[model samples]
Target: MTATAATEHVASWYAATANPAPERPALTGEIDCDVCVVGAGFTGISSALHLAEQGLSVVVLEAARVGFGASGRNGGQIVNGYSRDMDVIEAKYGARTARALGDMAFEGNRIIRRRIEQYGIACDLRDGNLFAACNARQLKGLRDHKALWERYGNRELELLEGEALRREVNSARYLGGLVDHSGGHLHPLNLVLGEAAAVESLGGRIFEQSPVTEVSHGEPVRLRTPQGVVRAARVVMAGNAYLQGVLPALEDRSMPCGTQIITTEPLGEELARELIPNDKAVEDCNYLLDYYRLTADNRLLYGGGVNYGGDDPADIEAVVRPKMLRTFPRLAGVGVDHAWSGTFLMTLNRLPQFGVINGNVYYAQGYSGHGVTCTHLAGRLIAEVMHGQGERFDAFAGIPHLPFPGGRLLRVPLSALGAWYYATRDRLGI
Candidate 1:
């Protein structure tokens, strides 16, 4: 996974239907810039885009291609807010911190839409997402969720149950659901690629297949790759899960987890519409949840299950197909066109960690499983910090992060056991 060895995009539906993009050259020599960004996924690209728009000299270095990590290989749902709810934040971090985060919870979605319109990035932009409930407890939770979001000034939500919920999901698996009118889904890879193009258009430089092997944090930060070096006044570590060896401090507090997805063959317009009447992205209420949405080509893209140590399942399809069948028994014999897995960084608290090291090197990671929107927000917050506005960023940085209790050797099994307990609770509906 290091930048020394070149890697291509994963063999997923997103890659198969990706837009034609030019191959960016790897860094060959030392380059100087105002800022050097590590990792060209959503956070790196988004941070670069925001800074470049401000007319700063920005350089991006990626271990592989742009959006090669969780950015490209995600559920693609623009689910707003953090992995933990606002109430959870309030309980742990105080009301002021909760208010600050709540205010910016949905800003990432706005940032995305603005980029789409400003740059004309076409990634099958759609509207609306549903949070499905599997039982009465979850159904009531969704009701409270609606009220909680509304309290935070998010009124673009509606609670639905019984026949009304069926109209949205068309599945017997869910007892009820809540819809986020502002939340939605899209082609994530294309979105990041388009944003990278926009970054270049703003005069930012991005080097693909350029892994930063070593980082010397001083007055002028130095990032070493196999073939070249980047010298800059400041550095932003946005590598998330794939970012290993360079900064063990960041890696120590986070664990990489893998999630698998499978896309079925195009079911035609009629069946696709029948499957999702409104075509909104759907995620069920569970400790380890299943999320799904329809692609522009009318295929049902379904994903679920997690491997705590970022280990790929023996057969991605084998792990996900049964879940798909359970959701839609009619698709028993549906041929899967693509199956893939992507790793995302997970923290014990299920909240992102943002901080500065040595007063110049900044980093944001550990979005847990709620990264699609948060990563973009992280970029904006990082940009604000670089611009000397640290109030908002401090709110996130103020939240403390603890390392996995079992450390590297035993962290996976310990986490898996904890997950099993909650998942069992979810199954029993207690």
Candidate 2:
């Protein structure tokens, strides 16, 4: 099965404001390396960077530009933990697995910060994330959330409501919220682009517009692209939602979900602060939630809603603008400058799917909606296993991931039905 031809990054607010970067040439000849990574998004770039730092020859093949997928177009919130929280992991997978996973939950955030400082990458880092609750029940859940994370040794939390909560977000949509001081946001595209540069600086090779069309796994895995082929000691399949046909097994267990975002014209420093005081990223607590943050230039970058099957909505702003208006009614007439959508792989259990295929092929995907931080963590774990340390890697790989029921035909409606059920409950405040 051949993969789709590589393309350019979607035109997004991030892309418009992105730092200047050269267009890397496509792979056109055979190459050999210690490792060949498929896809140049966060996962592939992160993995390549880590391995290169270890003195291993690494070549990354990207279907599009680095950060073209979710890495460039996500909510940009550095949310810690998996899509499903630690308590869920503990309940379903037992304490040992949860402990292993929890230990590395916050490590991704650290890796990002370290790389930024060490490499002088300027991604406009911010210093906090707010989890706003729409109702009393959700607020109570935030309290429990705070406690659950604290149990896992993360104490950089503060529960606030009424005036206290208003001070942080100033929006009336939230009854209260929990602030994760350790969690924050940044320019996601720039972060991944910087990481890709870091990988190159470490003598790593990254070929853009080089999508792996075929894989022949063996002693030395062979990956075939349109114009070239890569023979590597190992292969890392890090193309999340965008990777298709090249690996049917990975696609079977995960469903690609499209998410939409719209960026409003700069609200000015004063109005931006009034909307999100203290300049922290904010995501509400709901089955289908809304996440928004102020860009460094004070533009309100807000995103939400999900479309199963990775189909971009016809009108992105139509799907997301109302939610933004509801959150900050004061910006009712604010003009939206850019609207776009991107796809992220969602697993049945909301945990990332990590494992080996044919023993020499390693892949990690299905980050659900929490790819920003988890992808960084995935890179480190993959590097660790390659270095003969598999304990942490096994902890994630050992978790079982079942394929979505009803197969391709019915999976979308089935998942939509489940989302509708929870969304109904959210509306009823149950």
Candidate 3:
């Protein structure tokens, strides 16, 4: 997408109410740093912060302004765990690796809180999340997942049944749910922007409007942009879905998927409390999941709409408003103040992709819909590996990610075909 097209694509509620930051200069001349990061989303910024804090000279190049991608406009749920369930990981990688992965997933949430406190970021952090089951089968699945979590000795989950679930969420559509105190919500844009500030404070350079156009790997990696280039010993590709053709090897490993969200005009405290008395982020177990949370200002922020094709549908409100009303009919007539969409990178296995290409060029993406927390953990892991401490990073890198069938040109169609199957399964409760 062109720069203008990218700007037009971002009119999210988070952007509209984001905390202002100083404008940084665009890259105008060639520069060099110990580490050069491409794309200024959460992964890039967080990686830059961690590297800079360790006293490495780092420079970040953003295609657009900071917090201009999915990092800024996500559902804001700091969900604990990978996009793939723990059992899936255990089945694939055995119990030991699965437990390690599960512990890392929980650490992802803790890392975000630690950064918020360490940087004094004011992103309206909350401390609750609900995984609501749409049917009895899903409820049973939730119970099984809870049991596994307890077996692992990480039992921070509270099981809510029937009326108990209704008391917390005011939704009769769900049977029972799991409330996780460790998982919560936050102002996503604020968190990204704050991290960017923290990166700069740690003596890192961030250049906005500096889209990397070309990359060459040799003794020293080189990244070329429209106006400038960066040469460094190491390069980190943190572009995620907006990466375009920066790294062709990653193209087939992940596909860009669009997800939409809508926010209503602020509901008063009383009404907001009535909607979600516990102020928890709520999400259903459907293939096309419905996740919603109340903003710090009391607006109902509802998000769900996964499209394999990258196009952003014209009628954002039309597509997601009904989903919102299905859970909160009391807000049926409430005006939708904002509607926007973001592109998330999803892998075939629904797990994050972390590996080094050609040894020195590191890339991390494919968070699926579980990035709000995982990206932070990814940054830390990437930093640790860069500093010669690769234990945890190697564990994640060990998880293999297959290239999307049909390659780049046909992956979307292939994914769409697969999505249909899942959607049908969700509808049939099978």
Candidate 4:
């Protein structure tokens, strides 16, 4: 559960191009607040902002600078829906609960748009997303997915086929795609940092470089950092993959899996338009999905491939460059400007984990790979639960999550073995 490796993995394109913000002072001496939040990522920051708006005293603790984790380093695809499909949820839960969850997913996207407008966070917000089909089987799957979504009255998506998709993407690699107008892309780091500023403006205190080393629950929870401590009426653990062993019970529900991304040098307006004609973010239908989008500066930021264990694969470009070339080989000679990696929390059911650890201590994590929009909704729901409205929160809490098989030491290997099976299925076109 050490975070030394996680800290070293923070050099990203987002970090290199981030705008300057005032340095948040580190935690010093002891303090108390109504709520103490761990991890200053999207979930924690968004929660702090909402809680502060409700006139609650809140404090946020971060191990590094603001937006230093996956919140800053993700592919920035603000996709709608949960990690698992709604139909799968309906099969497990009842149809009523599944439809409610679908509505919640749509609400999550609305919350993101509202926050961006309210805060005036200028993060290069774009308007569309394309879920492409790399093979014939995937093409059929995308069509089925479109019909399923339509069944839930979610009809903002269209299924493209034949030459229509090829005309838009100019990629013979994909047979067709599902275009979701509800989904889009943005500069994630800017969004996170801007939300942090909004939280501070609302009188919430955020401490950077203040990692929580221990926590003890009493009438008021006490969170201890290296230099200081925070005593609050309640505590929220939003650290996600970087949670480490701060909360052992929560840590067992998921494992940290590393994903890599690389951005090529600017491709100019003509080539950018040719790559993604309508300037939409694109991800192919694969167990290990390939996602990419064009930056405001015209760089093609492509991401795919995952490292199941803790190994940070060398030659990231060697692994991802060919995938990018496969889609847009026209950029074969384009030089990659920045190559980086980040860790995402993956749950056993591929669903987000939301539940109260004890009674007063609530935690949310394990959004799988569908966190950009879901995290915002999670924050709002957590805020509602704190404000004595726990209906929606309990709905998500009903979903069960089990600890990874094998003990702490063996979990990684077990996960690697499981991932290999899915990887094989994706390759065999199952």
Clashes of each: 0, 0, 0, 0
Give stretches of model 2 more than 4 Å off.
1-6
Over 4 Å off, model 1: 4-6
Question: What range of 10 consecutive residues in model 1 has the weakest lDDT sum?
Answer: 1-10
Candidate 4: where is the Cα deviation over 4 Å?
A: 1-9
Report the candidate with higher lDDT, 1 versus 3: 1
How well does model 2 score by local distance difference test? 0.91
lDDT of 3 by residue, 1-430 (tens): 1344364227888988788887778798888889999878888988899999999999999888888888998999989888888888999888878978877868878889999999999899999899999888899999998998776565789988989998889987888999988789999999999999999888999998878888899758988888898999999999899887778877778888999999999999999999999899999999889999999999999998698856889899999999988888888889999998888999989999899988899888889989988899989999999989998888888888888888878888878887788878877888
Candidate lDDT scores, in order, read 0.93, 0.91, 0.88, 0.86
Q: Write the per-residue lDDT of candidate 4 for residues 1-430, one digit (tens) a residue.
A: 2324243226677877777677888799999999999988898988898899999999999888788778899999989888899889999888877977877878777888999999999888998899999778999988889888888767899899878897557788888999998889999998998999999999999998788888898869998887899999999899998888788877777878888899999999998998888989999898888999999999999999877644578788888899899888888899999988787898888999999976888888898888899889988999999989998988898888888888668888887787789878877878
RMSD of each: 0.9, 1.1, 1.5, 1.7
lDDT (tens digit, per residue) of candidate 1 on 213-260: 889989799989889999999999999998888788877689999999
* TM-score of decoy 4: 0.96
TM-score of each: 0.99, 0.99, 0.97, 0.96
Best lDDT among the predictions, by candidate number: 1
Model 2 quality (TM-score): 0.99
- Candidate 2 — which pairs collide? none
Question: Can you list the residue pairs that collide in candidate 4?
Answer: none
lDDT of 1 at 400: 91
The whole-model C-alpha lDDT of candidate 1 against the native structure comes to: 0.93
Ranking by lDDT: 1, 2, 3, 4
Model 3 segments beyond 4 Å from truth?
1-9
